[model samples]
Target chain A: MPEGSMGISNIATCTAPVNIAVIKYWGKRNEELILPINSSLSVTLHQDQLKTTTTIATSRSFQEDRIWLNGKEEDINHPRLQSCLREIRRLARKRRSDGDPGLDSTGLSHKVHICSVNNFPTAAGLASSAAGFACLVHTLARVFGIEAELSAIARQGSGSACRSMYGGFVQWIMGHQDDGKDSLAQQVEPETHWPELRILVLVASAERKPIGSTSGMHTSVETSCLLKHRAEAVVPVRMDGMIEAVQRKDFPAFAELTMKDSNQFHATCLDTYPPIFYLNNVSHQIINLVHQYNNYYGETRVAYTFDAGPNAVIFTLQEHVSEFIQVVRHFFPPETNDGHDFMFPCVVLKAGPGPCVVDDPTQHLLGTDGWPKKTE
Target chain B: MPEGSMGISNIATCTAPVNIAVIKYWGKRNEELILPINSSLSVTLHQDQLKTTTTIATSRSFQEDRIWLNGKEEDINHPRLQSCLREIRRLARKRRSDGDPGLDSTGLSHKVHICSVNNFPTAAGLASSAAGFACLVHTLARVFGIEAELSAIARQGSGSACRSMYGGFVQWIMGHQDDGKDSLAQQVEPETHWPELRILVLVASAERKPIGSTSGMHTSVETSCLLKHRAEAVVPVRMDGMIEAVQRKDFPAFAELTMKDSNQFHATCLDTYPPIFYLNNVSHQIINLVHQYNNYYGETRVAYTFDAGPNAVIFTLQEHVSEFIQVVRHFFPPETNDGHDFMFPCVVLKAGPGPCVVDDPTQHLLGTDGWPKKTE
Candidate 1:
């Protein structure tokens, strides 16, 4: 530690909402740059129900940078972690050199210790990486007093994390630049754009780590010709259609496109050599139930989309939420023997804002000593 | 009833082997003609293990065309059935017009009674339609005494049935003709070509009827853009690769391609709107086992392919059959409580010949009266 900056510490806490891709991001053109093969769209869920709370503490007394994810210290040397840290520091240096008065010079050179936790169970098949990275970058920015476009930095952490930087509708444009400078997430609409639109996360009973999106998508790019065609021909059109539907608040159109795109993403997964099976029996039954339920109403009342795992993220109007939940419970009866009220727990949320700074001191996950506070 | 030929009944019986596609047939361009969107290749299982036997009886005394499948009467008015019968009769008339004196004129005008039965359990998930249609067409040709390119007739019965027209390895050529006159199945290699290749039908425990190929493929064609790209860009190269592998008797190359194509077919199934779920937990576990087993051996010792259901049709060289079967039995233990030796009954078979006429009188499924004999 530098003697002049001894015992100096700065802390920032923030929470980022989880974003469910409506037009899925599957293949990548540039692995290192995290440049996607096709543009993707997502709806950011309300943070109160589903989010990652990340607290970053920077101290001149700290010997090195570190991170604790959900109470366990993970490898701080992970390549993606380094990428995110490097990009953020680089942006902070540029702002300081450009005579930005608000830039914290001491915190810029200080080592950071990040503590992150999710509100929902990590085993529920919900993707935490997006929210985790988004919250990390957002909190790090606040501590360093650097606030420009941070989504590009989050993109360096995880491809889908870029979309989580914005609330409501967001699109990750697949830029043509070799350097990936133009490839960044842009907001299509704000949180209040569609008030009646609701999102439900159906936590599937089976909890297994799916084939990591990085490796799974890498194989798809290499082996699946169908994926190549899909990236080139199919997704571009769907991205446009989805944006239009969200803009018009056309529930039926948005719901249909969301389901189709999710199905196609999983299709590409299966098309990969040796194939990948993510959705299980419960997932399939849920798909059938949703379609049957929609058919009974003679219109598309509900739509289901699955990510890399079996848990389904459903999109429907506010009016249909109760009925859809009832249908899900009836079909997948809760196991009373296990003392659970639901076979798959349902988390209901609506579109909400992106990462925001936490002002309350009690919510701080890190102590003044630049380490995660012990939980009782 | 026609009094002129009331007492005359010409009966012919034939058996056809069940063919499992390595390169799957999933869509059609011409539904009426049964012209496939993509060419497909299949290995015919040995008749001794899995096959369909059909008896065709032509009698002027019969009031109308009738059919029985597995002892139960089925509507003969089915369009595909009508297409097969009409094509055979049309071909018979053409042969007679060409001054072929041996054509059976009385049998051509007679109303036909068709009876078909599968040797393997229908609940085993083995495709019976391909074999059933092939046997029906082959037996019909014998009774009518017309035998020039009968595969085109079989193709009308089922898109995959055309591949069952020839032995060993067969390819259904997806012709460019709108009329489908040139669409025909060609033999890639006879049953004698690959002597050491073996097949095992893993009869998965779950035995629900799958989405019929006709309806399934129809939806895929309509809804899945990935299916479109696959037919256009993927299968052509795979077909060539598969044919070369079969010719070289290359087990590794053949196995890899077989697994890839099957995965792609199911991938297209998932891409279908209201997405179809063919592979269940058992199917997924079997897939993982096959991959793990091959990985353990450090070579492609076995390969698996699934059609429209959970049952896995595995392919391997003769040297690996016993060990692989042991692996399968160990992983999927037989149901001792149900008195079944194998939970998934394994029927070992080798590549076999096409449909053949049953010359023995006692083998006829229909009695001398031109009616299906009652099952005792």
Candidate 2:
């Protein structure tokens, strides 16, 4: 039999959503495995704003494994991607030995071809890796017929990336003792817990990122004492504050900590050796306007926060979302020459249930009739 | 007397720097007197960024007290301004009775005419009121030859106004007892103490304020449990952190606290019943970029903050200033186009010392002949 002809008979595929860290994941204690020093949290925005959709297929007919991103085939040799694939295969091997009925019935074989696409910018502080890893893990799990928890396998891909595996409010518990044995993501409060909350994302400007989180976190760990204090002293208080605020549906408390935590996180970033520039002039103006407008209205109405880009993620009650939209429109009036470009591109999404299988996993790897069939 | 022929017989002038609060002051217990609920601290930037230069003169020829701000004469009947003037006068009366030789011997008459100009935006978040009222009180003291502490009197004009009276690090004591008599601005440290520090300000965007600070504070007082918690819980920790950061020359700590305080202050603004929007996208971007860049570099190199306007003010050690400037310039590249002319309007300035006596008060106001004369 020809080498390329073996591709179609063996493999399977799947897709998953990308996640962005609200409480960022900065440092990695173990680089090869991509493990983090502490737990992080993030909001998985709706797929419309940003997401990753990937499909993985395996066949006994295939000669070598292959991959494509955004329709263009990328080098699978990239170390980060390689590590992820290798880890998932190792996990699948363990599941295969369990002798489970589910694993035995898939009639699967092992030459894989994976293709992924990101709806947003790649490696530009948008946490593209989070979605990439989640999808990779999910695809491999489905292919091998491994029924174990998806998050456990995802954690092997990237520490922060694991949290992205689940939806709604998820927490990455950095288990005590450095072997990283028990570290995994757990869903804390579901999306439906707070239905009235709305997020206003202001994409101030999307310019090329000056630096990547990998190198940045390396420098921060080596140089910043402030980082130590923040990770140890401040984060604990903030986490407590966050949990209480979320539980009570206390907008005032939540807004206060959200803004404070965002700034403190960035402050730690600045405390890093050479410094960082996240928020720009337009970003600053939005923060100020929200502050003064809120003060004018005299109540806890809106909370605005910023992540790694010149984008603002503001949370306000559903009742005042229209007001937020109106005020933002008025302040950042439409530009002439330029079509309807918003200084703050507001994304209003109600959180969804945790990640679930989007496609049926019971179908055969090849056509049921056993003819040379379609390719994904 | 012919109105055209009327001229001032005596004039006294003074200048005050605009103070930007490091730990902001908001929510006054006594609105009439502008007594703040908590002690505040600020850095008096160079007069080049923001300051109020005022000229005060009096003559029997003038029928009533009158005032002009930024070239336009304002209605003296406006209660805020009126109260400011009357309060200063009452304090001046006490100074005159104390047998102050400067007041008793100066050749000056009644019916004062004052003119003031704010180098920065009048009502924007740059704290123009702080400089405006501080300049007013300082000039009033000079004219009345009042020996009383300028800060104590400045407080009556605007609570945070007191901090503007001095140069460098200043603290506005919230005072323990209910009478609020002891609540006043006091010098924490002086500017010369940390001359190596550099401030890079990014003017995000400007807006005509929807509500002034006075009204904003009033509304915050009426609502916002977050405001109460901040006054009791957050501010104290920040105040301590700031003072220590400044005293120890700990840039990492200082940067963190400064950034944290700014975000927290704005958060409180959001927590206000109706909510206020003080910052814009530019402001938020500045913050995000700072985080990304700093996280990339790893160590304390720069710190960013925002006032009530959509502007970003960043502080860093003198050494990194050039790099920051270059980065900022690169990000906001200059471009020009027009049908008939080229315009590059936004100019960046490195601030200098705050408002001070340029023409000697005795030489110009008292005149060489020992008689005050109107220059105009």
Candidate 3:
């Protein structure tokens, strides 16, 4: 009856795509459950361009759970992390108790070792939390042999993470129930919905330490009357329009709504008490350049959305990508081809699939020994 | 009578202090009439530190209406300029028609010549329009022998100019009148009411060409839902609290409201279509600095407000002025005392009287011949 008599060990590696929200998710009604105040829709960028690969291994012989984020050890007792693990374990136990034919009943009680790493450089300042958490939840679910809808479990890690659990266009429904069961992400459209849609991530030149999203949203919910109004009166209508625009493949309609929603999100940030400024001078200039560029063409060829940071996530059709990239360079010229300011890391991305199991053993971030593999 | 044959001319030079809004006035119900969407309150800074000295002359033999601003000739037919002039003339004609014995009916047909100049350097980038328009209306009224309230007339030139027409704490009431007669500035407290209150104008060294207030407000009104909510739901209660704060001389209450209203105004700007950015990076830093300083003291010792530009106008009590100045210098060190970024032009000011007619001939910006006096 020894724990390791059968040497029970299972490892799953999953890669998740980053989602850029057109209808932004800002505040949360239930902080612990990570339920949003309003439903939000986002475009899942292709994983070939930007993604987070998470490798999770569970072993009965392991003493305790441990987690490494980008090769750095983090507190395993973090509330959100604990919540995600607890929910997945509960799901696995339920599946086994229901007499499911395929279930790793022994691994359900096993300690897990998790390691997540992003494909893109951290200097880009693109928020990886969405993809990281989504990957974590997906990989954890796989290792635990639980196949049920896991967006709700990912929701416990981060509100936006729920949306990242789906591919292409996704919306996180702000569920009404107190238990947050119905508050799961739904796929508005599949990966093949819009092949021409492209996203440009304009990395900020200056490194600005902006306020973290969790505290920012907390303050916005508490002090900002505008945030309350937006959540109650504005977002519901915006969500419908966004869904329609995505379904119709209307770039201009989609672009305009995306930019407005992003601006409104920052507006609420500024409206918070003592006010939070996520957009720096560079972000402001980029915004003007986008409008000016659009005005010049008499069309919104490109749209930008910021996520609690200065880095701009631009949405444009594949046809306009080259021209808009030229314009961005012209306005914000990189000092040189290799300058930091113009890192010009334009990962031209299109709508892509969500978390997928990676069969390649070499792609795992965690070693067979259940620890982060050191990279030289 | 031959032109200049009888030099029957009356010249009055009046200086109007600059007023910084604690409760901002953004967006107008009527563009032509300068009717505001919401009420706003301001603190009129001392004329000695910052003012617009405007000299107006009404002469029977002058050639035509002319204006020279800051020694540079400007078009006399600007619509807002014409509005102020026409209103002043109508008031004078009514006074003369009523058969007032002291009324100079002779000057009724006279052409006016105006020469306006700001005491603060143009490099300061403070909006001279408010003080300039207030002074123009007041001085024109004095020269034309009409003593009725002039904030309504000043408002035509610039929306914020109306608040500058009064000393101490002034509020521009957003009256529900088609004619905008009731939307005039009212004095909540005299200059002597809050003597301990002080203002520090932290003029920006670098000039930023922001969207002009008229166009910015126009866009906010047309596009931003947040602006509408702010005008209707937020400002009325804020206006009352601001007035009470002023009347009771509650520095902390007044300071908190000032910062919040300023932030809300900027929030509306960001919520505008394409969004407008008034507070630059420097302004944002100043805001953080103020909040941090206040936090350090365990009391709200100082508060900062930014209008439609980068310059920060900080409100604090006289007792904390020296310490705050030191803190500002420590945080934003001036580069060798003459660097452009650290102009550090902190003009300490207090509430002062409204425009007053300067009887001294030496102070006149206009010559006896109704022409601009050269400033050699």
TM-score of each: 0.95, 0.63, 0.95
**Residue runs of model 1 more than 4 Å from their true location after superposition:** A1-5, A101-104, A336-342, B1-6, B102-104, B335-342, B374-376
Instruction: Please give the distance, in angstroms, between residue A120's alpha carbon in candidate 3 and its true position after superposition.
Output: 3.0
Q: Score residue B46 of candidate 3 by CA lDDT.
A: 84
Share of reference contacts found in each model: 0.88, 0.06, 0.68
Q: Which run of 10 residues does model 1 chain A get worst, by summed lDDT?
A: A336-345
Q: Candidate 1, clashing residue pairs? A: B334-B343
lDDT for each residue of candidate 3 in B3-116, tens digit (9 for 90 to 100) = 465453688889998888999999999999999999999888888878999988878778889999888999999999999999999999988888899776777888999999
Please tell me which predicted candidate would have the highest DockQ against the true structure: 1
**TM-score of the candidate numbered 3?**
0.95
lDDT of each: 0.86, 0.66, 0.86
lDDT tens per residue, model 2, A280-334: 5566567777777778888768877666666778878889998888898888876
- Please, what are the lDDT tens digits per residue for candidate 2 over residues B131-243? 88888877766666665776777777778788888888888988875666788888877887787877766655556656677788787778655566667766887788888
The number of clashing residue pairs in each candidate reads 1, 96, 0
- Write one digit per residue (lDDT tens) for candidate 3, span A1-376: 2245434388889999888889999898889888889999988888997899999988776789998877788999999999999999888888888999866587777899898888776534565788988999999988888889999999999888898999999999998999999999999999898998888888875364467788889999999999999999999999999999999999999999999999999999999998999887778878998999999999888899988878888989989889889888877677744223454636788899999999998987877677788871
Docking class of 2: incorrect
Least well predicted 10-residue stretch by lDDT in candidate 2 chain A: A364-373
